[model samples]
Structure formats: C-alpha cells, structure tokens
Target: MMVRRSGRYTTWRGFKDFALGKPPDEEKEKPKPEDDLSNHDEIFLKSIVESPDFGRKSEPIESEEDLVVKPVSLDNVNIIRSLSEYRGNNIRTIEQAELAILLSRIHFKALIDAHDAIGALWLQRGSGIEEPPKQDKDTAEGAETSPEENGDMPVETVKVVGLRKVPGQPLGLTVTTDEHGQLIVARILAGSAAAKQALLSIGDVLLEVDGVQVDTEEQLKEAVSKPNDRVTLKVGPNLKEKSSQLTNKLSCYMRALFDYNPKEDTLLPCKEIGLEFKKGDILQVSDRKDPNWWQASHVENPDVVGLIPSPELEERRKAYVPPEADFVHKISICGARISKKKKKFVYESRSSVQLEGAELALYEEVARTPPFLRRVLALVGTRGVGRRTLKNRMLHEHPRRFGAVVPHTSRPPRPLEENGTSYWFVSREEMERDAHAGRFLEYGEHNGHLYGTHLDSIRAVIKEGKMCILDCAPASLKLLHNSSEFLPYVVLLAAPGIEQLRNLTFASNRNLTEEDMKQTLEESARIQRQNEKYIDLVITNHNNDTSYSRIMDALHALSTDHQWVPVSWIY
Candidate 1:
C-alpha cells in the first residue's frame, strides 16, 4: 500500500501486511502513478481527482492587467470594531436592522455586536440622534447625498420572532431548515457567546439550547435570548445519521458547549458600531480586516456596480471585490457594432452625471438611477433571480433615493401594511373593476394568488421622474414591450451558457444540487436560444463579478454614450 507524503507517494514497509487481503493477480499488477495513494487528506485528494493547483503559485499581473492589491492591515480591524460599537450603541429597532446592515459594513463580529447593541439601544432608546435641522426646500430637493449625521449606529442583535418582510427591515437569521430538509440554523448572529461556545454552527440543528426545549424558529431565538455566557445545546442528529438507521436516542442528545474566550478577531466595541453605518457614509472610517463580510453576504459587490470618487480610496474598496472585471457594457446604435461584439444589439444606459461640488462624488452620483427606472431594472431577471431581493438591495444601496413599486392589487392588505406604503392591498372587487376598466397594465397569478400591476405603479415612479422596473415572465415580455401603458427599454439578462448558468445558481446557495444545476443550466440554455429571436439586447449573466459591472457598463452605453432611448421614454 502506498501513501502520499508531502508532495510524493511512497510505499510503507507494512504495505504487504495491509494488502494481505488483495488477490495475488491484483497485487502483481503495478499501480499507476495516478493510482498512487498519498498522505493527502480526503478533501485535498478530491480536488486532485479533478485538477490540482499544487505547486502553482499566483502569477504577477501585467501592468496593462491593472490588478491592484492592498495589504490587509490591523487598521481595518479597528475600523470594524468602531463600526460594531456604533451599531451596539445607536441602533434602536428591528425595523432599522436591515437598513442599518445595508448602510453598514458590519458583519460577522459586527453582526454579533449589532445584536447586543440593538438590544441595548432598544433599552436606552432615548440616546437616538437628534434629527438634522430642516434646510431650504430647494436644498432638500437637490440633496444628492445624505448627511452622515443622519446615520444610525448599527444595532447589536435583532431577534425576528417571525419571518415577516417589513418594508425596510433586514433579514436576521432564524433557526431554519437545511438542504437535507433537517431542522438546523441556516445562520445565527446573536451576540450569545454561549451560542458560539456551545459550537452552534450555521448548519447545526437546534434541539434545545440551555435545556430550554425548542422546535420552531421562534423557540430557538427565544432560547438564545437567555442571559448567559455559557449554554448547552441539544442537537438533532445530522442527515448522515438519518440516512443510516440511527435510533431516536442517538439522534437527539444534549451536548454542552461553552463560549470560549473571545477570539482575537472579536470586534472591538467601536468596530461593531461600524457594521451599521452605510459603507458610503462612514466618516473617519476604521480600517479592519474581517472575514464576516464574506460570511453573511452571498457576494461582495456581486456586480461591482457602484462608482468610486477617489482613485486612492477606490483602489482600496476594489480589493474586497472578486478580482474579475464585472459587467463590461458596450453600446451599438442603428445596427452598428461598438465597443465589444459581446454587446451587439445592446443599447447601454447609465444614469450618472458627474458633478464637482459634493464631498463625495460617488455617494452623490450613486442615486442617479431614479426609483421608476429601477422598477424597470427589477423586471430584467427570470423568476427567483430575486426580484424582491433585488429591489431591497437596490433601495438599501440607494436609500431614500428610491422607493418600491407598491403594486395596486385587488387583494386586501395585511395588517400593519398601509395603502400607499408597503403595498396597495386592495379588494377583489376593485381589482375586477380595474380589469374591466382596463386599469391594469399587467396582471398575473403568483404563488397561487392573483396579483396585478396597475398603471398607478408606473405612474408613481414616473411622478418622481424615475423609471419603474417591473418584472414579467418570459411570456409577458413581448406584451409589456408592445403595451400602450409603457414602452420601456429592455435589456434581456440571458443565461445562454449552461456552465455559466450553473455557476450563478450554485453561487446563490439556493439548494441546487449537481443534477439540479445541470438541469437548470440546460433549461437556461434552451431559453436563451429561444429568447435570442425576441431580445433587443442581451446580457448573459455568468454570475461572476462581471455580471453587475457589465450591466452597469451597458447602462452607461445606452443612457449616455449612445443615447439609445427605450421606447418607454419616446412613447
């Protein structure tokens, strides 16, 4: 028997003894180089079974390649600590958690502090920052960037009793189901040192914490709320156990886990505060290097969509993004090729207008894309590409610069939901009356419920001189394009390459298995081929950092470079 050691394989002295059970003929045959057993761990070996990167060092980029690397320093850590402290000290409500998260760079450790800070902030709610004094109406209207003084300190912890989509609330972790359909925590961020000590992993199922039995998400959250530095966890056995025939007693057992000493990576009080401040609004920002940024968010600047004002600062921020040029946009007009053939037939549009007066050019120009146009942007994806989540991320990125398209539906609104706020939950009777009166621009059945987009949704966005981004299924795209209600510019997000499509799906942590990825990729390929006939412009999303950047680039080409207006604008 041969074992891999270091970088080479060697037969051990006791191989003959270990191989005693092998047949004589099998033993006679020499093992191939590929078959040589090595000391490599199973995890490393698995990758070798495919292709290996061993001994392959990272290469230096060409000067033209323009790759910039920044050394991660201790200062980044302190900044993270300051952000965490701010969240802990100032964040006041659950409603503000998501917004704070959107506004802040706090995650991982900061998230932990935000958890505690939110509780403390809630308890001492009187410390809320006073509102900024009113300015002239014209100044307020033209305010491109919000003052940092209006910013809230990141909240420490937010325990969501239920999974309700509050208009501006952040999505906190609750003990949830795993890919195997087993009850486990999808993620946890409470500052319960005990929870961490007890080794409560992201995928660990909560049978009970501290002997406070829990079965539902709510119960798990409540169990974690106990005031202590140490806690015990009763865990349900893993999926592998269930696959075998584990007994019930074996499946459920109480295990004591303790919060070990705070790791050096423990966010400082102030670092936690930084978590809740908008990355764009951080003044005197700390410099901290933390992995939590990668932990919570699926991708860092997935599309790399925003602009950078300072060349020096932009270089620093770009370090966090994946080292890939995201979304490369080009414009074509009158059937002429432009910057890249990849963008053939694509009319790019960008909403930004550079101005010199603001303290931060990027911050001021960030909100250039108005709410209405954004609604149109939302409609660009296939179902589950996250229309709602997309809207939320956009609004979070833009703040009050944009608002959601509250559909004027016929259904009655849910409790605490307002008429012209979260949504216009209406009556079926009114819906029917609107349908008969031709008030609906687009209508459909969703989640077995009837939902319609009335003209009012578009009107609301246009009222703000913004374009509305509406989502429609592939079948409805043609109708939307032809409709008299609006003639919106269409930039089709096509998943043409199967391999690329699979990467996008898998990257999203959407429980896509290998087979599912293969199947969806094939389906996407088919759709892309079919869609090619109708698409005016196509942007194939490979789910790389380039996807969003390409989209942004395309927008620039359409809106500014080429002036290729959508039919919506002209009509």
Candidate 2:
C-alpha cells in the first residue's frame, strides 16, 4: 500500500483515472536529504546526531558557533540528490519525506587511551570541544598580545599527556587550559584504580588544581598531567542549582589518550561520568552511541548478558491487531493553540490523532468513501488569532473529535523545554552540524526562527487514526502543497475589516493606531490571497459574535461529513 505505480495507488480504482499519465510530479518522486528544505533549521540537524535511527551517515558540531552545519558524505549527497529530483518532478507525498530521514547517517567519534580498552564507543550529545577558559589577571596582563589580537584572548592549543592508570582503576589524566580556566581531572577509566578509590569522579567539574584556575574539561586534563603530581584538587559537588558548590581533592595520575578501546567503552579519567545521575546508576543511554543493552545490565556475570533463547523471540509479535479493512475506516484529528507565557507568546497543542482498532469497525462504511468526496477543513491564520484556543474549545465542547498537525524545528533551547514536548529543540550549532550530517524531513526559516516538520509526527497522527491540524507560518504552504501525503484542509482566518481590526487591536491593549491597524490588515489580506490556492476554508474574526458562530458552524459541517477530525479529543 505504501508503494505507488504509474504515480497512482493501484488499489484505488478511480485513482488511476484521476492521477494516471500525470505530468512529472516532484512529490511523487523519490525523496532524499538535500531536497527536504522545509525544515531548514539547526535543531533538526542536531536530532540526526542524537537519533538512534541514524544509519551510516551522521555528523556533529565542531564548535559552539557551528549552528546550521550540513552533512558532506557521499550518502548525504545521494539523499539530497534524490530530494532535488523529487522536487523537480513536483512529486508531493509523505512517503517520499519519510524515506529521506530514514536514510540519514548517525555521526559520532571516540577518544581512547592505553590499557583502558573495553567495548566500542561512539560519540554522544555534548561531545565536542568545551568553551575556552579564561586566564588569571596577572598571567594575562604579563603575556604579550598576539599580532592578531584586538584586546581579545590569544589563540591557545590543548595538548594531551601520556595517560596514567590509577591504582586498582582504569587510566585517566589531570588537564589544564590556562590560569583563568579551572583545573580538574579528565576521563576516569570505568573500573580503573581512580574509579575504585572513589577519590576522583568524572564530571567533578573541577574548580581549581593546586590553587590554579581551570574551567573546561581540556584545561582540567592538562593541569593533572604533570610529573610527581601530588596536586591539590578543589572541586564542587555536582548539584542542579548554581549556588550549590562543593570542593575536594587528592593525589592523582594524569595522562593523554589511552590504548585504543577497539570496542570503545569506559569513561575518560576525571571526566564527569554522569552529572545527572548518581554513581553506580545507569545514566540515560544516548541514542548516538550503539550501547550493548546486555552489557548495561551487567550483573558481573557473562552468561546472563548473552541473548535469551526462546521460541517467542523468533515469532512475530502480535498486537491488538486490526483487519486490513480497518485502515479504510480511520479518522484523523488535529489541534492547535496559542498562549502568552513569561511575556512571550507560546504556542502548543496535542497536534494529531488517528482513531483505529475497534473504533473503526463502527464506522467502516463511511470511512471507505472517496477521500476527496468530503469537504476538508483547513484553518490558516496569523499568530495570536486564538486559532489554538478555538482548537481547544472544540475538544472541550466535543470529546474525541480532532487530530493535530505536528510542527518540527531545529532551533536549540535556552535551558528550557524538553525533547518531544515543546519542540525538539537542538543547537543551531547542532542543526548545521546535522545538515552537513544529512538528517531532516523538510526545513525552512521564518521570522528569523527556523522550523521543520518531520514525517514521524505525520505518521504518528495517522497511526492514531485522526486528521492532522497543523499550525505553521505561511511560508510552509509551499512545501506542504508539493507533498501529497499531507492532504491539507486550509482555512484562512482574517480580521473582519480594517475598522474592526483597529478597534479590536486597541481593545486588546495592543495600543495600535488606526494606521498601524490598517497596515496589519493589508499584510494579513496579502498573505491570505497569496495562499488562496491552498485555502479549503475561511473564517473572518470580524469582532462580533458572528465570527464565533460562523467558525463553529463550518467546523460542525466538516465533522458531520467526516471531512476532518476535530482539533481536540472531544469535539
């Protein structure tokens, strides 16, 4: 069913007459990386680095400012090329987009040392050069400025010393960047002497080494890598709060890269093993690395770590299996919302739903009707237009009624937001990092912010048996227009008229002058008309009870005809 022949679904009888012999359509073409420009942001790139799904082709950020990096491998090129061809042919479908992300590579690297060999290791998130450290005032004042210096820090290089194995522990080292940077131990071999002694823990976040300052991991490594080092290490206890600082230190062995761990595993000496979790506890496994799940549950016994032999393992897993005919009876729903939080407008929603299982059995007849026979309901409006509020109202007013359109982005978060929640925020640095790494659906930029919508969200909504209610900027229309997998139900929400818009704007405390209100109205109208071709529905917020009634009526009509799933669970 996922495959297409002659650019049409062979199973759908009328599809052949409707789409057969059509002009070369890019959306119908094969999908690839470079061609998915709809989600052209940095965070999407980072996801590729962090995604467990990354295949052979992946990339990483080299520095803090490396946002918007793109992948450069041959695989990446091929994927991009496929997308380009698809776009050129005007083939629009979600299947093509899904193919692009699945084909991307996972990028990572491992740094190893002597005699500390273990399992093979792959790079994970936050695996890159730390920010350079600062130097002491006296040391900085005395040092001569470089020719290129314009009152800025001079270029400094980091060097690795021979790794030293702690008594009864794996090898590691004490490193230092400069006077301003704090000194700390780096990379303690898992189960190494230093680790067993418990005198030194990785990610101690060293504050100072023998009264010297150090900040970055590299700097900490440098300081402890000295001869006859009975150095004093002042460290802060790891805490979530900034004000919670603890310090301690003991004698330590310092070193550089260790013996190659062909099966790259084990932490570097002095490196914080897991800042977020306590000792002996398994840290959240990062998808970037191919960790042996069996090894993680290591009970100090090898036999138990091996694969479990069972007949069930070889057999197909069963679910609350539905019949093939059930998919035809599925319904789709979408939701959108906007709110003002912390002085900034925050938009959020449940996004999409796909109703299936026993639920579809009840509506099998209606679900089999022609896909286009019903009128689709699409809502398009500017930001802060209560689009999301209305979506919530429908669900409140009618339970189990709507689906959502998932939006994707590659923008990194500012110490807020969570993965798969607010937005899949990653570093712009990581975005560019993965761009070159080659992982994304469709990416683009709007209002200086980058946005992307991946296929996973689309598949998720469909899997839930609901129509997707998507919320995005106007620019995204072009990308959606070219993709067939996403059958758009667009509705343009515009202000009633200029005079009404001015009155509403002022009433809302926006304090807009008549001129400002008029200008805004003109712009909104232009955006609406520009996207007229995609508009399947329209609602006017003309500052009267009529607007709410009209909008509600349109939604009810659409639902009655099974044109769309409501924007909420109830409506």
Per-residue error (Å), model 1, residue 559: 3.3
Question: Candidate 1's residue-wise lDDT over 482-522, tens digit each?
Answer: 44455455556654354665555655656656676555444
Error of 1 at 159 (Å): 96
TM-score (all chains, Cα) for each model: 0.31, 0.30
Off by over 4 Å in 2: 1-378, 383-386, 395-399, 403-416, 429-449, 506-509, 543-545, 559-571
TM-score of 2: 0.30
Q: What are the Cα lDDT values of the candidates?
A: 0.40, 0.39
User: Each model's RMSD to truth, in Å?
Assistant: 32.4, 33.0
Tens-digit lDDT string for candidate 2 (332-395): 1100111121221232111211111111110000111222422223455764344665665554
lDDT of 1: 0.40
Candidate 2 colliding pairs, count: 139
